[model samples]
Target: MATSGLLNTDILSDEIFDESQARAPAKRCDRHSHKPIDMYCQTHDKVGCSTCMADDHRSCQNTFYIPEFIRNNIYQSVSRKIQTELNKITKTLAEQASKFKQDKQRLLERKAELLADIRRFRQEINDQLDKLEKNSVNEIEDKVKCLESKIDDGLKQIEALEARVTTASNKIAFPNPYQPDVFVNMKMADDAANVANKYMKDTKIKSTVEELDFKHDRTILTQLEQIIALGSLTEDPTKMASSLFRIRGDKSYCVKVKSDTEDCYISSACCLEDGPIILADHNNKKLKQIRGYNYTVTDYYDLPERPWQVCSISKTDVALTLPLQNEVHFISGEEKMKRTNKIKTDFECYGLAYTNNNLYISDASTSVYVYTLSGTKLQHFSETQSGQKLFSNIHSIAVSKDGTRIYVADFYNGLIVLDNNGQVITTSNGKQFCGAKCCYITKAGSVLVSTYGSSVLQFTPDGELIGEVIKADSEGRSESLSVCCNQQMSRMFVCSIDDNIGVYGI
Candidate 1:
């Protein structure tokens, strides 16, 4: 039915007229356009269509076809711009990192400095604390030692006081056993009275018979009275008994008899040169021996019941005292006889000491009687009041070598110092049991005291206790002490009731 040409033409028309529904929307171009409309393209941005470019967009500055533009340029200029911006951001980040690192380093350095300062300060504080602790410990130890020494000294003083007090109490409480009761001889008295009467009557008869005027014959009348008094004299045991005190020193001692005594207590002793003289004290009326281990001659002057104290004046002359009789007798060693230098006393004497020209005597009357070596009285000082402190008993006496001062040992008070004029200069108070017996002033100006049961105490001239020389045993009692002044030999000798003499070196 149809011809071949007609068929071909129909197919062409069908192909050419294919529907626009299958085509994508055209992109709007805005490359250089002042104004452009968007296109519906999935893969490309809004671009100008060919028609748009030929119309109003042809004069625009950025209007172009997407496909055409892609074909001609590879976007090299934009790529260059983006690369530059990325490089700048990276550099900025690097600079900021560097600054942060520097800041951290500074912080670390400052921390190190602060830590060092703290450590230094801490060390200084620790050092100070350590030093303070050590010093405190040392001070405590020193104080403890001082207190301990003081306690020891105090204990010693207490013991000495107890011993002396006990002895004194015993002496006072017990009565003497040797005291003799006196009775008059009635028969002898009557015979003497008759003889006196006969002589008187005969004389009176002769005078009256002679009638030679009764001129008062004073001499004859006095003789008659003497006879009458002699006739009445009675033999009494109490009067005949010898009132005596005895004190003995060691034999071979340079000083034999301080005074003279018929019988004496003698003990042999050894001591260092310049040691104090050792002497025995006799309170009870007991006959003493003249020599040690040997009964020497018995008849020596009218011996006292007991010689209390003896002092040697020289190699031949000695002064011995019958303290109870209140009398001192001088005797010669060569003749073994009493001298005429005898003197009687009214007070009871306890101790004797000698200076260069005089002798010092301590008495139970609490009086210090200073007398010349020749029985002449010099001065008296009593320790009673503040100015004159009277002691309960005078135990011992010591005079300075220069004779400027005298030291008195008071059984109650410690030690009393008196000037040459018999005035109290100073008193060692607060010293316990310091009243043993004797006190001595050393050449170094130290005072050495021999207490009863205590150790020897040494004191400075100013009266401060310095040290203790020796300690006494619990039962040992010190009686006397003597210092030797032989410049060749420096020694001190102490005597005790144990019948021993101790020697010490300076």
Candidate 2:
């Protein structure tokens, strides 16, 4: 029994050794030498042979035999560490997925709210129309009733006169008529005949036939046909945690944009986002797109009438007001300019601005008209809620980035700031705002005003004067008319009355 036990033990040992040999394989360095890897270089985080360590890791301070390194450093299982890292990654991915779901839910909620608002607006319009229809129907009914009542009165009078005449004739034709009765009947007949003659004369003067007609207001139908949507859809402005910094004009570049017989009278200008600056050359009757870096005209589009003011709608779209045509023309392109569409205004359009999918235009008289992108008149501001005129010779207009406030550059009223509802917030008629012709709102919410002369003044968003940014040149030829800043507030484009446009670094 002892001999069998020893043999069984030997067989078990041999089987265990063979299994270890089968599971583990010899590792060799995959270098040109192809040597067995037995050393670890902690500096390079690599495994190498003795020869490799001498040749490549001679200066490495942390070098050890592979077995010794593993014994000293590997306190935890590698598989466990890999599992921990993978679990952490999985948790992060789950959190990211949850955030995305929340964002999607918010978007869905916003869409639903917007749809409800549109429906409510449409319902209000329907209610108003119903009221108008009811009023009109009532008016027609009242007129018909009034005319019928007059005709009935006339018919009663005629019937009374006919009775008098008939009674008199019957009395006179009686077989045993008394002389007194006959004479009385004769007088009654004469009186009735005279009354009948008078009534006939009055009827000739009055209208015998009345025609009731409904004359609908053509303007209402025209407005309805022009309406593209109930209102505009825009993303809510994000509130940033960081405060905005004030910008200053650093340098100015004068570029000539005249290529016509008449000198260019650049009345308005707009800066695109990372794109060319557009200038409205009033004398030339053209819209010129010029590059800021090299100050060269890249493209130009001729207008039927002079453009008074221009505003950027998007990165590639812009709208310019044509005062003479009473139209707001929209042009779009990245590398070239082309007329896309237009909006005809009841008043002559002068100053123009676009914000939150709406266009605000000034008539250069007393009113400011607000319209949707598709030309539906949304609101008009001529007088304040207190019956005071909002502006005197309003020229250029601008809206705040958040679409909450409107800034008007009035020729005589100076800078007037109002809420989006046209309620006057404040009016700054400081000495620096003399002849305020054009106004621009920078990305940082600073207001830039171009006076009638060559000075371009800057003010805080609250209407406090910052300072004059640009002034007249040596020859006093820089008469700034329109001013605009790029989206980054890094550059400003100023349109002068002369043949040149001024580009200033802010």
Tell me the deviation in Å of residue 467 in model 2. 2.3
Candidate 1 global CA lDDT score: 0.51
The superposed Cα distance between candidate 1 and the true structure at residue 94, in angstroms, equals 70
Compose the digit string of candidate 1's lDDT tens values, residues 1-506. 12322112122221222233334334334554444433212222233445554564444455544343333334444445557778998999999999999999998998797778767877886797688667867776776677667657656755665554555445545545544311123333444455555644654522222342324436544333322121121234232222111112222222223343223332111111112232333432232223212212222344454555455556445565667778766655443345657776668776666668687877764778888866777888774446645666666666775777777666677777777777677777565655555665554545666675546666554444565566555333444443222112334445444333444543
Best by TM-score: 2
Report per-prediction Cα RMSD to one decimal: 48.9, 19.3
Model 1 residue 376 CA deviation in Å: 2.9
Q: How does model 2 fare in lDDT?
A: 0.76
Candidate 2 is scored at a TM of 0.50
Report, for every candidate in turn, its global Cα lDDT versus the true structure: 0.51, 0.76
Evaluate residue 60 in candidate 2 and report its C-alpha lDDT on the 0 to 100 scale. 83
Give candidate 2's error at residue 89 in angstroms.
56
